[model samples]
Structures are given as structure tokens and as C-alpha cells.
Target: MIQRPRGTRDLLPPESRLWQAVEQTARAVFGAFGADEVRTPAFEPTELFVRSVGETTDIVHKEMYTFEDRKGRSLTLRPEGTAGVARAWIENRLHDRSHPLRLYYIGPMFRYERMQAGRYRQFSQIGLELLGADSPLADAELLLVLHELFTRLGFDDLQVHLNNLGDPEDRPRYQQLVRETLAASREALCSDCQRRLDENPLRVLDCKVPSCQVIVADVPPVSTVASEASRAHVVAVEDQLDRLGVPFVRNPRLVRGLDYYLRTVFEVVSPKLGTNAVLCGGGRYDRLISDLGGPAVPGSGFAIGEDRLVDLLPDGFKVRVLGLRRLYLVPLGGAARAEALRLARDWTRAGVVLEVELTGRSLKAALKRADKEGFAAVAILGDDELAAGTVAIRELATSSQEVMSPAEVPAWWAGRS
Candidate 1:
């Protein structure tokens, strides 16, 4: 038999229900915040990511899934969501609509990387972007939404690790500082960090290698040489967060892997997964649109790694979503089976969650199956009940049974629910 590719997964029953609940929660929460959904192609020109995410980032340099299409033009599965959003903003002329477009997207992203627990080559992301606004309030709003989302998901141990990467002008000075500080320990640095020292010195701070991290620990925070204007911008963001009571910690060494981010960069980490596992990461990318050949429009946003989020989902949330009550309908005899569909349709129209037993299994077998599958109750329709215009309802938990008219079953189920 043919097997599925190594890095992909089939989100099967019950487990798939958890994913649906997550997506639905995201939609309701983001929609309440005035964020409309925007969807782009699963694949785009290879140049899109290179131009927007930067040439030196790992997403572009190592992880991207790029190939030549039938027309011999390079195409790539999107490795991240932000760059695609920027490209869509330019190509579709979204600038004409309104200032500060609030858009959210949930979709699969592809990356060719080594598989790990909670990480996949094919993964999904839930992202929100606020475009065309540079105000500190916009940044605060994003954080508020994030806090609300995690709260709704029942995550209590997550933390926001925030830092100011400064404005574009301050980058030259900051990069110089990193190079100078790590110069003495250059030989001890990893091969990746040594090459990044000249190409993109700030990338050295983001290195995960134990040796590189030790050397990078001594470098001065980027805020030390930040331009006065840039410093003021991030300070305002922090003040707003404080006023709003959204908790966060200032981590001097925090740096996002993408090149477009500047000013406010952050990652939300879960102690349950250890500090290295980032559940969500995003920041302000004021120059992304202009860099993508569009009018300069500032934007701030973040993407939650949906795969990992579900993997580390709180036990309470899993139980609530997966343990929702559903009724099993058992039809006895050929005549009862034929009439079952009509009753099932009527009850479902009345907002009842149920499934009719399609197979001709015996009543004893059907009840056993219902109990094993955790059905709240079983509705039994037989030749006698069909003739009498009534049904039997059996509560699995209480082992209680009641006879009622077909129309009354819906109300009874609703009451129990």
C-alpha cells in the first residue's frame, strides 16, 4: 500500500473536531475585532518570499519549498503568511479600499525542514495583520487580541517575550555593536553564526546553538544604540500595554528570524513546551510594503503555530470541545429504518445533534455501541412506536428510559443538553 508522505498528517475524527473548534474560536474572536478574512494562493512566485522575507533568513535560505512550474517559472509554497499578505496588498491594489485594513488568515504553510514533535513540513498558521497604521495603539490592539485568544483557549502559562529592534536607521549601529562584541569569541561561534556576523550580524543573536548563545549573551541590547525616535516608539507601545494590563517581559536578546520586522518584535512562549518553543511570533514591519514595490504602508501582526498550539492544548479545552454531547438514533426493523431518516431530519432541523444508526444492527448491539461512543442518550424508533407516533429515549448515564411523542424528543434532548 502507498503511504502518506513523511511530514504530513491526516487529521482524523474526534481529533479533527479539536481543530475545528480552534478555527471557529479564532474566527469569532478575530471577527469581533473587525478583522476580515483574506486568502491568497497556496503557492506564489519564488521571488515573493526572497524579496519580502529577506535573502539571509532561514525561511528563504533553507526551509522554503520551491520548484519550477510547468511554464518554467519558479513557484514556491508559502513558508510564512506575512510576505504573502504584503504581495496581495500590492498586486490586488488593496490600498484603494481604506486606511488600516484589518485582515486575518488561517491556512496551511509549507516548509522543507526536519520533522520534530509538534513541528511539521506541512503546518497551519492563524495570523492577523493590521495594515496602514503606524500608531502605538495598533500595536497594543494586536497584543490585546492575542491575550484574548490565549485566554479563550485556556492557556495560562504563556508569556510574551518582547524587544525593540529599533528603526531601519539604527540597524547599522546595532549590527556594528553585535559584530564588535562577538569578535573576541568568533572562533568559538557556530559556523552559521560566524558567517552571519558579516552578512547579518543581528541574526547571530537569534542563533539557537548553545555556544553561539553564550557568546551572544554578552552583546549589548539593540536598544542601547536605538535612534531616539525608534526608542520613543517602542516605549509608547510598552506604556499602552501596561495601561491595558497585558503582561509582558522585555528580553534584550529577542530577535525574530524574518528580516522585515523592526521596532516591536516579540514571541509568545509556553513554559509547558520549554522556552525554546515559540507558540506565536510577530512584530511591526513598517517597511514591508515599500520593500515589496508598493506604497509605504506600515503593518503589525503575528502568526500562531496552529499545529503546536493544538498539540499543547489545555486539557480542559480538549475535554470540552471533544466531549460535546451527541445523540444516537436507533431504528428497529425495515419499516422503522425507512421512517428514521424523516425523524432524524426533523430533529436535526430543531437544532439537535444526532446520528441515525444506518446499519441493520440489533438493538442490543446498537445500545452497546452508543454507550461505548459516549452518546448522551439513544432515541429508539420501532414498528410499535411508529404505529403509536411515539419514541423511546434512553439516557446512557442514568440508565433511565422514557416514552414520548416524536415531536417531544427534540425538546427533551435540548433540556438534557
Candidate 2:
């Protein structure tokens, strides 16, 4: 039998409720912050990522599933949503309307990597991007949105790991310092870290291996090694976070492993998940639009991994639906079945969760399944009841039965509860 691909999942009933809750909270929070939703296509031209997400990054270099479409147009499933949203902002001319277009997206993102327990090839993400603003107030607003979102989600003790990549003017000096430090321990560095030493030194700050972690810990913080301008910019973001009463820690080496980020990088991490499974990540990208061949634009935003966020959800709250409380129509004979189906629709119109046997089964079998299915109460339309324009309704939990006009069943149910 064919099966779902590796690193993907099917959300079954009841458990699917968690996804709804997450989406609901996100919508409420983002809407309150004036961020309208942006829905972009699942696929885009391959160069979008190369230009915006950075070709040297792991997402582009090792993870993207690139292929040519029927028309020979190079398209690929989007690994993340931001670049496409940015492209939409440019293509739709949204920038001309507002100062900073606040936007959020929720959807599946694709990646090809070795599947781990919580990792998947196709996972969902809820991300926020604020385009066309550069003030610290904008940064503070974003941080407040993120902080309140986590608090509202009931995730306590979340650690915010904050850092500064420093703006473009001060990044080169920090890059030089990183290269010099990496040169001293280059032999001890991992292959990926070594290769990144020159091109994007900030990435080496994210190594997870035991040996690499120890070595990287000794490397000077990017803030210490960065230019004075970089230092000042980082300080401003911190001051904003403090002013907003958002708690955070300064991790000198907390550079996210991406090339598009120019300054003010940050991560909201949860130590509960065995030391640093990041819940959200994003930073500033001042030159992304220009690099991608659009007019210059400043962007700062973050992506929340839904898979991780769901894992952090408290247990027992499930997808709540009108389940077994449904009125099951067990017509006595063929003609009665037809009448029962018609009655079921009328009952539905009155806001009743009603079920009629679809399978051509014996009355006893239908009754058995109704009881087994845990319906709250069932509406049975045997020939005797149908003759009177009435149905026999049984309350499953109480084992009580009554006769009522089909139209009155919904009101009867509302009264029953």
C-alpha cells in the first residue's frame, strides 16, 4: 500500500483540535496588533529563495526541493513563507499604501532533511513580518506581540535568547574578528562551521555538537567583536524590550544560521525541550529586497514553528465537536429510511447534530453502532413513528427514550442539556 512520505503526518480527529486552538490564538493576537493575514502560493520561482533567503544558507543549499515545472519554469515548494510574502508586498504594490505593512501567514513549509522525532519534511508555521519600518518602536511592538502570544498560549518559563548581528555598517568588522578567531581553531571546527568561517561567520555561532559547542563558547561574542555602530543598534533593541517589560537574556553568540539577516537577531527558546529547541526565530534583513532585485526595503519578523508550539501545548484539551449527542435515525423499513433522511435534514436546519444510518444494515446493527458510537441521543424513525410524523428519541447517556415531532427534536435537545 502507498503511504505518506517520511517526515510528514496526518492529523486525525480530536487531536486536530489543538491545531485549531493554536490558529485561533494566533489570529486573535495578530489581529489585535493590526497585522492582516497574507496568503501566498505554496510554490514560487526558485530564484526567490536564492535572492532573499540566501543561497549559502542550509535552507537553500541542503534543504530546498528544487525542480523544473512542465513549462520549464524553475519552481520549488517554499521552504518558508517570508520571502513569498515580501515578493507579494512588492508585486501587489502594498508598500505604496502604508508605512509598515503588518502581515502574518500560516501554512505548510517544505524541507528535506533527516527526520528526527519532532522534525518533519512538511511542517506548519505561523509567522509575522513587519515591512517598511525601522524605528525601535516597531521592534518593541513586534516583541510585545511575540511575548503576549506566548503568554496567552499558556507556555510558561520560555527563555528569550536575544542577540545582535549588528547593522550592515558594523557587520564587516565583526566578520573580520570572527574569521581571525576561527582561524586559530579552524582545525578543530566542524566541516560546516569551517566552510562558513569566511562567507558567513555568524553561522558558526549555532553549532550544536558537544566539541563544537565548547569551542564556540570561547569565541568572542559578536557584540564584543563588532563595530561601534553594531553595538549601539543592539543596545537600542534591548532597551526597547526592557521598556516593553519583555524579559530576555543577551546571548553574545546567538546568531541564527541564515545569511539574509543583517542585524538584531533573536530566538525564543524553550529549555524544557532538552536545551535549546527554538520555538521561534527571526531578525532584521535590511538589504533583502534590494538583494532580490526589488527596491530597497527594511524587514524584521519571526517564524513560529507550529510543530514545536503544539508539542508545548497542555494535554487533554482536544478537538471538541458535537459527537455522540447526534440523533441517529434508524428507520424501520426502506420507505421509513427515506423519510428519516429527509427528517434528518430538517433537524439539521434547526441546529441539531443528527446522524442517519448510511449503510444498508439491519435495524439491530444500526442501533448497536449508534450506542457504540456514543451518540448523546438518537432519533429513531420506525414505520410506527413515521406514520405519525414523529420519531423515537433515545438519550444514550441516560438510557431514556421519548417520542417527539422531527421539527421539535433540536429544541428538545437544547432543553435536554
Q: What is the TM-score of each candidate against the true structure?
A: 0.98, 0.86
> What lDDT score goes with residue 305 in model 1?
97
Clashing pairs in 1: none
Model 2 per-residue lDDT tens digits across residues 28-56: 99999999999999999999988887777
Off by over 4 Å in 1: none
Candidate with top lDDT is 1
Tens digits of lDDT, candidate 1, 1-417 = 999888999999899999999999999999999999999999999999999887888788889999998889999999999988999999999999988899999999999877777889999999999999999889888999999999999988889988999999989988888888888999999888888897889889998888778778899999898878877888898999999888999988899999999999888998878635799999999999999899989999999999999998999999999999998999999999999999999999998999999989898999999989999999999999989999999999999999999999888888877
lDDT of candidate 2? 0.80
lDDT of each: 0.91, 0.80
Q: What is the lDDT of residue 60 in candidate 2?
A: 87
Task: Quote the lDDT for 415 in model 1.
Answer: 89
